[model samples]
Target chain A: MPGEHSSKQYDTDLETIRSKVLAMGGLVENQFQDAISCFRTGNVAQAEQVIKADENVNNLEVSLDDACSHLIVKRQPAANDLRTVMATIKVITDLERIGDESTKIARAAKSITERGVTTINHYETIRVMSISASNMLHDALDAFARLDGKQAIRLIAQDELVDHEFRSIMRTLITFMMEDPRTISGALDTLWVAKAIERIGDHAKNIAEYVIYIVEGKDIRHTDYAASQLEDRTTN
Target chain B: MPGEHSSKQYDTDLETIRSKVLAMGGLVENQFQDAISCFRTGNVAQAEQVIKADENVNNLEVSLDDACSHLIVKRQPAANDLRTVMATIKVITDLERIGDESTKIARAAKSITERGVTTINHYETIRVMSISASNMLHDALDAFARLDGKQAIRLIAQDELVDHEFRSIMRTLITFMMEDPRTISGALDTLWVAKAIERIGDHAKNIAEYVIYIVEGKDIRHTDYAASQLEDRTTN
Candidate 1:
């Protein structure tokens, strides 16, 4: 309790930076949702808006990263505090990458709009998958903010669903291309959009993994343990 | 000269970490090269080898990240030293992602081999584009290792050529799918491989941008100015 006043200030600083990361996460989620809506509704203006908003999302990443670094240098907090700062840095990086994938989705949406979205009517699959990926991203951010390693592990399980949807979309598109050669161009466009969405899920999973690293001090990427070992470990 | 000796030790610590990062880069480059060769030569064995090597690459990432956090906490490095550590963190993240992309390429290679690799004869464009992207990654690591901002800018310019190659491959595949429905499945397989290669270039470009950020303290990502401002800045 001797350092009580400064400790309170440190907590406030950490909370403020975490809030900034959540803000960036919210922006990226919007970009992804709007990109999907553009592809679904053939709204060229929305697609263009999403593309322009990506710059703002990127700027947020740069600033938030600098904030995390400044926090480390100024506070020089040891152990858990240092891990928290490092995790925040990694989370913002994933958020920025999710924004980049959203831009790709927007670009593909614009192309599909130009070609007419009628024949390329597989937007339903994209819609479902994007909603799932967007939600994963949302929960991943929540997991990071709350430091709930349990919830983070659950999101990792959900990424497999996204991957399954991606393969399903690919199969449907390939069949469409084979049936009508005229749909090849539009199918390819839609495929690109789906691919972007799939990548968003991967980024979200990465954010969740970072959360577990913060909460549990375990790096579970490139492995299945996170999604598997969720039962008795909480008691430990 | 009072802090000269300690400062020299700090420089050595920085160099040692940078050397580890470059070693990781070399390993990822080998994974990418072997992945492409696996696809080109229809060698399932080599493809499996590349896939297995991805785990080692991932392990290296986790260990290197821990090392970086230790450096920051122990050194309490400020200003340029802090930036170097941060940049190294970012560079390794990109390299790990490149390893993931290489795993995708190797998986696609294995799939192509199982499919007899005969009808998916678009290997030439993939080979060309992959070589361009691989060289970009190599130079990006060199830029990071040498702290060469100018060379980093050059690598960014070269990424455009890889993009061009990707677009060319896309066009050719779309035509192939349209002209003969029989090739639709094969075309899709090849497209996935092309996409993984295209993404390798992108991750490489991100590494280059980080190089510029470290050397010039400017974030030039999602911008064209880095590649354009080389000539006049030498005097500055």
Candidate 2:
């Protein structure tokens, strides 16, 4: 009770920062999903919308960064509080990057649409990868909001599956380009889309790592996924 | 003189952190250059060396972050000092990313070497782009070290040239893949290498922006480059 009373304003400041991060996360998730939908349905307008909405993500990042700086200056937060603020700063960066990846996907979708190449069958793998990556982003944010290290670890493991899917799709696209040179343009666009989704998965995994760092005060970044998985299991 | 005496230790701590960041930047620049060399010469051993050197970059980043955190906790640096530390933190992230991009280029070089495709004629453009980008990175780090906002602004303008080279390389690679399907795999590897180099340019640009922020207390990030250029000209 003594600690709670002493730190009311600090807690409120942290909460405000957290809410802003979550709001930004929600918008990034929507941007990613809409980008994928545009790619799947060839909706040029929706792709343009996704590109335009990136400004909001950018604005939120700037504001959140400013708020974090103010909090650190005013509060001089220590230990866990400092880690929490640092994690928020890092998380917003990954979120903003995810937004950029979404923009890349949307731009690729628009280019493919403009090229008048509507061969939809080749995109099944990309669609699946997009959904998986988006879900990872959603759950990564959930884990962060809940401060659930275990859930974050699980999301980190999921990155391998996304990577595997990406490799498989890349191979398939290469083969398609070799079989018929005419498919090169469309296949290249699909390849960019897949790369964007893979990058999004990477950003999501980075967020999960930040969550673990926040909750456990452990810097688990740069460690191999399999090694971290072993550590996660042994600890739990 | 009283203010200087009071903050002597704080200034020393900041200098130590800045030196670590410069060391890390030097290593990253070497890694990027070596990776490019590996690709141009098809030297798998050099490619492996570049990949191995990335561990040092990663270690440096961890120690630098720890040092920054310790300084923040102990000194509670305010205003310009706070901005300097924040910019250092952000710059190190970009430096670490440059290392990662170098690793990607090295890996791509190894793959291309394995493919036994030593068509060096097509790599002239990539070679020029790599040199340009490497120079930009070197200058950007020098600007950061000097806290020269004008030099940083100039580096930001140079990013446009790197981007133009990247797009031109992409178009040429695509054309090569379309003309000769047999070159598709090698072309893809080269594409990844080019993309990695382009991303390094972006990271360098990000560092320059951070330098400007540290010196001018202006948040020029995420702003239009042309607008910033105009501002830079008028201010000078």
Error of 2 at A55 (Å): 0.5
Shift of residue A224 alpha carbon in model 2, Å = 3.3
Q: What lDDT does candidate 2 reach at residue B87? A: 85
- lDDT (10s digit) by residue, model 1, range B157-207: 888899999999999888888899899888888898999999999999999
Q: Best candidate, lDDT-wise?
A: 2
Q: What alpha-carbon RMSD in Å does predicted model 1 have with respect to the real structure?
A: 2.8
Model 2, C-alpha of A66: deviation from truth (Å):
0.5
Clashing residue pairs, candidate 2? none
Model 2 residue A148 distance off true place after TM-score fit, in angstroms: 0.3
Worst 10 residues of 1 chain B by lDDT: B1-10
Q: Which parts of model 2 have CA positions greater than 4 angstroms off?
A: A1-6, A119-121, A225-236, B1-6, B119-122, B225-236
Q: In candidate 2, what are the lDDT values of residues B52-88, reduced to their tens digit?
A: 9998998888788878888888898776678888889
Q: For residue A208, what is the lDDT in candidate 2?
A: 96
